[model samples]
Target: MDTHFIAFVLRALAVRLHTNRDFLSWYEHTKPDFILCTNFLGGSVIASIAKRANLKVPIFVYAADVFNNPKAGYCSKIDRLFIPTELGVKNLLSQGYTKEQVRLSPFPLQPSIQQMEKLSKSEARKLLGLEDCFTLLLNLGGEGIGSTALVKQLIKNKLAWQVVVVGNLSEASKQRFHALAKQLPGMSMHTPGFVSNIGHFMLACDVQAGKAGANALMESLSLGRPFLINELLHAARNTQTFFLEYQVGWVIRQPKQQMITLKAFAEDKTRQQRIEYNLKALPLQFDSDQFVNLLLNEVKSLAD
Candidate 1:
């Protein structure tokens, strides 16, 4: 009766039945010392394939989400499991992994994002030609799911706050936002659909709103911007605690409610300063080089 259980069973059956001759052939041809994988499904498949190949290759899996399933015994096949948060490490430990079997690593931001120039609030606003007023960044992942509702609330309430919405919005959604932009002439509504320089946009805003996805959360914190999370996936469920515990942000839903909080937050400069300071204090962001070196050192140690 449980949907998750049924889905898990179907996936397990598929994993058992799945076979890729090309993958196996390629593995045999290349014969790497070890394998590093990003997701559980791929890691499990690679582990099964490696065992079938009769190779003593090590497999490392960096869990993209906090794996709450303690019964996921397939993870034992992984030589090392890397988790990004202390809460994740706790979850895996409770999942029966040994101390040596798990490694705690910060989620590494993309090189472009990490290396981007850190701009002051005034400098960032100037670069984007944003008004020196309360600004909010609404980026609900690539699909831009919750953005329209929030923007409508802002328009209906006649709020003059600046909004920067960045996502791969549908054409219809773009037209809708364009029309709405005309209604709120005082507000600076920037709907730069699907931008590459998201870090710059983030720096220009006082707060970010979206799903508590791994990348979005890390990117916001890396830029020292507080995140107003509305949705959470299974993997991101633990992130709520991180936000609450650190006084960095709040988890609120409903466009009207979010607007109310946004208005209040905008007026409270001391609170904004506190949240920004807290965001900067968290040890969440890492560079690409550090991530690569960490993996390389681990592989060398295993080889030795």
Candidate 2:
């Protein structure tokens, strides 16, 4: 695993892969039917190896996030490519893949979201211990990085809304939030770090303030809740495109812009209803069983 040793080995393997029999003798003994690669760079290298072997073995590449591949046709080097978003499909096409090679599939959601118990807003609010006041859910997807600033801003300003900040990772972050909560006597806020029952909170809040990550996007769309995206970067940019295409949510750019947007959504019931309607109109969702079946069938065919 030394960097110099790895570079030297790759060079030696490239020069004498077949002649240097011991370098990769494991492949001959193992004779894997196909190689599936989840890692971005490793998959491309593995595919190249299969190509050099005259493709006796096939390659199946799963794109981890939307537009995550760095190289052109990196996933296309494989026999089959599974991309999770329609935007991802376009990215592959731009990278020079044929229509036959790529398949758009749903990103697998958690069991909770798949078997999500549909709750009326009142019921969901009761479960989250939220009052009937305007409610906002602060979830920055699985990473739990952003939203501390927004949390303090709302509480310090004493915004008349119930704010539930879920899924923060570290204890330090949680403490900072709790400490801020104590400073404001009348402000309504809740901080719960990383819960499996995020599905409940998703249904409970009026607006989901977060980044454009897949889980948050899918859950918001599934629950027919408007997602007020807090940032768009890297893979999140692809999510922004999807939201724009469907009019599912507002992509926040400036800090002041989000506050203005939130105020409008808070004050206007009709606009809130409109945003939720757009999110529901989209066909995006997570059917984990069906997604798993697709992968299984592909694997079975290769194995046969």
Give candidate 2 regions above 4 Å deviation.
1-35, 67-69, 72-75, 140-143, 155-157, 182-185, 299-304
Steric clash pairs (candidate 1): none
lDDT for position 173 in model 1: 74
Q: Write one digit per residue (lDDT tens) for candidate 1, span 113-147.
A: 88889998778889988887788888957776765
RMSD of 1: 2.8
Full-model lDDT, candidate 2: 0.70
Model 1 poorest ten-residue lDDT run: 66-75
Model 2: which residue pairs collide?
167-194
Residue 235's lDDT in candidate 1: 56
Question: What TM-score would every model get versus the actual structure?
Answer: 0.89, 0.79
Candidate 1, after superposition: displacement of residue 274 in Å? 1.4
Residue-level lDDT tens digits of model 2 in 33-133: 66767655556566655566564776777776654444532534567777777778887777666877677876677788779789988898898777766
